[model samples]
Target: MNLASISTKQYVEQRDKGYWIAGTRISLDSVVYSFLNGESPEGIVQNFPLLSLEQVYGVITFYLANQELVDAYLKEDEAEFRRLQEACREKNPLLYQKLKAAQAQKNSAA
Candidate 1:
Protein backbone atom coordinates (compact mmCIF):
# COMPACT_ATOMS: atom_id res chain seq x y z
CA MET A 1 0.00 0.00 0.00
CA ASN A 2 1.02 3.59 -0.56
CA LEU A 3 2.01 5.93 2.25
CA ALA A 4 -1.19 7.91 1.95
CA SER A 5 -3.32 4.81 2.13
CA ILE A 6 -1.46 3.57 5.18
CA SER A 7 -1.72 6.89 7.00
CA THR A 8 -5.41 7.17 6.25
CA LYS A 9 -5.94 4.10 8.39
CA GLN A 10 -5.46 5.92 11.66
CA TYR A 11 -3.49 4.24 14.40
CA VAL A 12 -5.05 6.55 16.97
CA GLU A 13 -8.60 6.97 18.12
CA GLN A 14 -10.26 9.89 19.90
CA ARG A 15 -12.16 8.91 23.02
CA ASP A 16 -14.18 10.80 25.63
CA LYS A 17 -11.11 11.00 27.87
CA GLY A 18 -8.26 11.26 25.35
CA TYR A 19 -6.61 9.73 22.32
CA TRP A 20 -5.64 6.09 22.44
CA ILE A 21 -3.93 3.83 19.98
CA ALA A 22 -6.58 2.18 17.81
CA GLY A 23 -6.21 -1.40 18.93
CA THR A 24 -4.71 -0.94 22.39
CA ARG A 25 -5.36 0.78 25.72
CA ILE A 26 -2.15 2.77 25.40
CA SER A 27 -2.65 6.52 25.35
CA LEU A 28 -1.30 8.62 22.53
CA ASP A 29 -0.30 11.19 25.13
CA SER A 30 1.97 8.70 26.87
CA VAL A 31 3.73 7.90 23.62
CA VAL A 32 4.14 11.56 22.74
CA TYR A 33 5.36 12.40 26.23
CA SER A 34 8.02 9.70 26.05
CA PHE A 35 9.12 10.86 22.63
CA LEU A 36 9.28 14.48 23.74
CA ASN A 37 11.27 13.40 26.78
CA GLY A 38 13.99 12.22 24.36
CA GLU A 39 13.23 8.53 24.38
CA SER A 40 14.06 6.68 21.19
CA PRO A 41 11.34 4.68 19.48
CA GLU A 42 13.08 1.52 20.63
CA GLY A 43 13.11 2.81 24.19
CA ILE A 44 9.41 3.64 24.02
CA VAL A 45 8.64 0.16 22.76
CA GLN A 46 10.69 -1.23 25.61
CA ASN A 47 8.79 0.85 28.13
CA PHE A 48 5.41 -0.15 26.69
CA PRO A 49 5.69 -3.76 25.75
CA LEU A 50 2.21 -3.86 24.32
CA LEU A 51 3.08 -1.33 21.65
CA SER A 52 4.88 -2.22 18.48
CA LEU A 53 7.67 0.00 17.16
CA GLU A 54 5.48 0.86 14.17
CA GLN A 55 2.70 2.10 16.42
CA VAL A 56 5.16 4.21 18.38
CA TYR A 57 6.58 5.66 15.20
CA GLY A 58 3.09 6.41 13.94
CA VAL A 59 2.26 8.25 17.17
CA ILE A 60 5.46 10.27 16.95
CA THR A 61 4.77 11.10 13.33
CA PHE A 62 1.27 12.23 14.17
CA TYR A 63 2.57 14.41 16.97
CA LEU A 64 5.30 15.93 14.83
CA ALA A 65 2.94 16.52 11.94
CA ASN A 66 0.42 18.22 14.20
CA GLN A 67 2.52 19.61 17.00
CA GLU A 68 0.40 22.70 17.67
CA LEU A 69 -2.88 20.82 17.80
CA VAL A 70 -1.45 17.90 19.76
CA ASP A 71 0.20 20.24 22.26
CA ALA A 72 -3.09 22.07 22.81
CA TYR A 73 -4.87 18.77 23.34
CA LEU A 74 -2.20 17.65 25.80
CA LYS A 75 -2.47 20.93 27.72
CA GLU A 76 -6.21 20.58 27.97
CA ASP A 77 -5.93 16.98 29.08
CA GLU A 78 -3.44 17.97 31.79
CA ALA A 79 -5.74 20.70 33.04
CA GLU A 80 -8.62 18.25 33.20
CA PHE A 81 -6.45 15.75 35.06
CA ARG A 82 -5.46 18.40 37.61
CA ARG A 83 -9.08 19.43 38.03
CA LEU A 84 -10.14 15.85 38.66
CA GLN A 85 -7.30 15.35 41.11
CA GLU A 86 -8.35 18.45 43.02
CA ALA A 87 -11.93 17.28 43.05
CA CYS A 88 -10.88 13.89 44.37
CA ARG A 89 -8.81 15.51 47.05
CA GLU A 90 -11.73 17.71 48.03
CA LYS A 91 -14.01 14.71 48.17
CA ASN A 92 -11.59 12.77 50.37
CA PRO A 93 -9.37 15.20 52.13
CA LEU A 94 -8.32 12.84 54.90
CA LEU A 95 -7.61 9.99 52.53
CA TYR A 96 -5.69 12.27 50.19
CA GLN A 97 -3.67 13.66 53.08
CA LYS A 98 -2.86 10.20 54.33
CA LEU A 99 -1.83 9.08 50.87
CA LYS A 100 0.35 12.13 50.44
CA ALA A 101 1.98 11.54 53.78
CA ALA A 102 2.65 7.93 52.93
CA GLN A 103 4.13 8.92 49.60
CA ALA A 104 6.33 11.49 51.27
CA GLN A 105 7.49 8.94 53.78
CA LYS A 106 8.28 6.49 51.03
CA ASN A 107 10.20 9.14 49.12
CA SER A 108 12.18 10.04 52.23
CA ALA A 109 12.98 6.40 52.84
CA ALA A 110 14.17 6.05 49.27
Candidate 2:
Protein backbone atom coordinates (compact mmCIF):
# COMPACT_ATOMS: atom_id res chain seq x y z
CA MET A 1 0.00 0.00 0.00
CA ASN A 2 1.22 3.51 -0.77
CA LEU A 3 0.59 6.59 1.32
CA ALA A 4 0.75 10.15 0.03
CA SER A 5 3.42 12.46 1.34
CA ILE A 6 2.82 16.15 1.84
CA SER A 7 5.32 18.97 1.59
CA THR A 8 5.90 21.45 4.40
CA LYS A 9 5.22 24.22 1.91
CA GLN A 10 1.68 22.94 1.59
CA TYR A 11 1.16 23.38 5.33
CA VAL A 12 1.78 27.09 5.68
CA GLU A 13 0.81 30.10 3.59
CA GLN A 14 1.80 33.75 3.61
CA ARG A 15 -1.37 35.77 3.30
CA ASP A 16 -2.41 39.37 4.07
CA LYS A 17 -3.12 38.20 7.61
CA GLY A 18 0.40 36.77 7.85
CA TYR A 19 1.39 33.11 7.95
CA TRP A 20 -1.65 30.86 8.18
CA ILE A 21 -2.43 27.18 8.04
CA ALA A 22 -2.79 26.66 4.27
CA GLY A 23 -6.51 26.25 3.76
CA THR A 24 -7.70 27.53 7.14
CA ARG A 25 -8.02 30.92 8.80
CA ILE A 26 -5.82 29.73 11.69
CA SER A 27 -2.45 31.52 11.83
CA LEU A 28 0.93 29.83 11.99
CA ASP A 29 1.71 32.28 14.77
CA SER A 30 -1.13 30.89 16.87
CA VAL A 31 0.27 27.38 16.67
CA VAL A 32 3.86 28.50 17.11
CA TYR A 33 3.05 30.67 20.12
CA SER A 34 1.09 27.88 21.78
CA PHE A 35 3.91 25.42 21.14
CA LEU A 36 6.44 27.89 22.52
CA ASN A 37 4.27 28.30 25.58
CA GLY A 38 4.68 24.54 26.15
CA GLU A 39 1.56 23.23 24.51
CA SER A 40 1.82 19.84 22.82
CA PRO A 41 0.70 19.26 19.22
CA GLU A 42 -2.34 17.50 20.64
CA GLY A 43 -3.05 20.45 22.87
CA ILE A 44 -2.73 22.86 19.97
CA VAL A 45 -5.17 20.79 17.97
CA GLN A 46 -7.54 21.05 20.92
CA ASN A 47 -7.19 24.82 20.98
CA PHE A 48 -7.75 25.09 17.25
CA PRO A 49 -10.43 22.54 16.52
CA LEU A 50 -10.13 23.28 12.82
CA LEU A 51 -6.59 21.84 12.80
CA SER A 52 -5.70 18.20 12.89
CA LEU A 53 -2.74 16.76 14.84
CA GLU A 54 -0.98 16.16 11.52
CA GLN A 55 -1.40 19.78 10.50
CA VAL A 56 -0.20 21.01 13.89
CA TYR A 57 2.88 18.80 13.76
CA GLY A 58 3.59 19.82 10.19
CA VAL A 59 3.41 23.48 11.14
CA ILE A 60 5.72 22.89 14.09
CA THR A 61 8.23 21.12 11.87
CA PHE A 62 8.07 23.95 9.36
CA TYR A 63 8.63 26.47 12.13
CA LEU A 64 11.67 24.53 13.45
CA ALA A 65 13.21 24.13 10.00
CA ASN A 66 12.77 27.82 9.11
CA GLN A 67 12.90 29.32 12.59
CA GLU A 68 15.05 32.32 11.75
CA LEU A 69 12.96 33.37 8.78
CA VAL A 70 9.72 32.72 10.64
CA ASP A 71 10.94 34.68 13.66
CA ALA A 72 11.82 37.67 11.51
CA TYR A 73 8.42 37.54 9.87
CA LEU A 74 6.76 37.35 13.29
CA LYS A 75 8.73 40.35 14.54
CA GLU A 76 7.78 42.35 11.48
CA ASP A 77 4.17 41.30 11.86
CA GLU A 78 4.10 42.37 15.51
CA ALA A 79 5.57 45.75 14.60
CA GLU A 80 2.94 46.27 11.94
CA PHE A 81 0.20 45.38 14.42
CA ARG A 82 1.57 47.88 16.93
CA ARG A 83 1.80 50.54 14.27
CA LEU A 84 -1.80 49.98 13.21
CA GLN A 85 -2.95 49.97 16.85
CA GLU A 86 -1.19 53.27 17.48
CA ALA A 87 -2.69 54.80 14.36
CA CYS A 88 -6.13 53.76 15.48
CA ARG A 89 -5.53 55.18 18.93
CA GLU A 90 -4.37 58.47 17.45
CA LYS A 91 -7.37 58.67 15.16
CA ASN A 92 -9.82 57.82 17.93
CA PRO A 93 -8.36 59.03 21.20
CA LEU A 94 -11.72 59.13 22.94
CA LEU A 95 -12.60 55.60 21.93
CA TYR A 96 -9.08 54.45 22.81
CA GLN A 97 -9.31 56.04 26.25
CA LYS A 98 -12.64 54.41 26.89
CA LEU A 99 -11.33 51.04 25.86
CA LYS A 100 -8.21 51.51 27.96
CA ALA A 101 -10.29 52.42 31.00
CA ALA A 102 -12.56 49.46 30.45
CA GLN A 103 -9.53 47.17 30.19
CA ALA A 104 -8.08 48.63 33.37
CA GLN A 105 -11.34 48.17 35.15
CA LYS A 106 -11.55 44.58 33.98
CA ASN A 107 -7.98 43.94 35.11
CA SER A 108 -8.62 45.50 38.49
CA ALA A 109 -11.65 43.31 39.00
CA ALA A 110 -9.45 40.33 38.33
| Most accurate candidate by TM-score | 2
TM-score of 2: 0.87
lDDT tens per residue, model 2, 57-105: 8899999999999999889989999999999999999999999999999
Candidate 1 Cα errors over 4 Å, as ranges: 1-8
Candidate 2 Cα lDDT to native:
0.92
Candidate 1 matches the true fold with a TM-score of 0.86
Q: What's the CA RMSD for each of the models?
A: 2.4, 2.5
Predictions in order: lDDT: 0.90, 0.92
Each prediction's TM-score against the native? 0.86, 0.87
Q: Candidate 1 — which pairs collide? A: none
User: Could you tell me which residue pairs clash in candidate 2?
Assistant: none
